[model samples]
Target: MDPISLILGAILVGAAKGSGDVASGAVVDAYNGFREALRRRLAGRKPAQTAVEEYTADPDNWRPALETYLQQADAQKDEELLASASAVLSAADPDGASHGKYAVQIYGAQGVQVGDRNIQTNNYRSGP
Candidate 1:
């Protein structure tokens, strides 16, 4: 995924999980942008507005439905639409899910600040 999309997705998800009703900061802008993009794609298709609203209101419940549209966008090779859908989906399920399980793992670090740096460690080291 592109860096912009990734960041927007993260912000949107954070806002969705953190904000109560109205999102603030980049989250609001990102959500609006994604929604507008998705709206354009759904213009010809009815029930889209409702679906989008549902996603905005309750993402966790409507994620699967949104994903269906995402797949359609993928099949058509519509990168823009795909990114928009991905943004919404990411915001809906920040933890991310695939095949009925979490796709991303969260690891905690002790006595250190884990910034953007990537860290890998051997969980089962045999000897020192």
Candidate 2:
């Protein structure tokens, strides 16, 4: 997945968990912070604000709107927003269901490893 989708997925998962009793303490706090960050980023836009409201009310059905809102807000480029969303996801799903239980999405990546205990060393040098 692209960064945009990755972050959006995290936000959605966090939202789902946060709305339920499963979320408490740190999870709730992180989820709230993520929502607040999104709200601040989308302020002064009635449609965006409406999308957020709708998403909060019905996360399952309002995802497309929130996704659009995120795109309009340029969420992918906002490291702070990304971090906030990631925090919520981490707090809500500590086992990293963020990438799916056993799935990972990697694109244009190098020397990436998963599902194993391994060591890697990189000696990258670029020249003509």
Candidate 3:
């Protein structure tokens, strides 16, 4: 490969990785925020009533905001966004796999298998 092509490829990869990181961070932050809010509510601390209104006032909703950041980080490449979103979503799930191929068995009243469902699992990992 030409030097320029190699450099471009490296840049693209770096951007995708960065986008994934940003998306993952945003999701984690949102999760933490929600948890804190819940804790405060449970503790009898009344949350601001306008919080939801303020959130909705933003042009992009929560998920869309994170996605916009990811897209910008990846130079607006559809493929890059798809790849990064997959990575971020996987990071949010238990198996660390980009796609869902896992199932959770549901039990009935008598502990009999009733059905199965797919659930999103959020498992975080530190650096190797």
* Candidate with the greatest lDDT versus the true structure: 2
lDDT of 3 by residue, 22-110 (tens): 54664554344433432333243222223322333442334234333333344223343233333333344536343342222243433
In terms of lDDT, model 2 sits at 0.69
Please tell me which predicted candidate would have the highest TM-score against the true structure: 2
Q: Extract clashing residue pairs from model 2.
A: none
Note the residue pairs that clash in candidate 3: 93-121
Question: Each model's TM-score, in the order given?
Answer: 0.41, 0.63, 0.21
Tell me how many clashing residue pairs each candidate has: 0, 0, 1
The CA lDDT of each predicted structure is 0.49, 0.69, 0.34
lDDT (tens digit, per residue) of candidate 1 on 36-86:
665666676555456555666676677457556544544235556555545
Off by over 4 Å in 1: 1-24, 73-76, 82-128
Task: Sort the predicted structures by lDDT, highest score first.
Answer: 2, 1, 3
Question: Which wins on TM-score, candidate 2 or candidate 3?
Answer: 2
Candidate 1 TM-score, C-alpha based = 0.41
Q: How does residue 71 of candidate 3 score in lDDT?
A: 36
* Better TM-score candidate (1, 3): 1
| Local distance difference test, candidate 3 | 0.34
Q: Alpha carbon lDDT of residue 87, candidate 2? A: 78
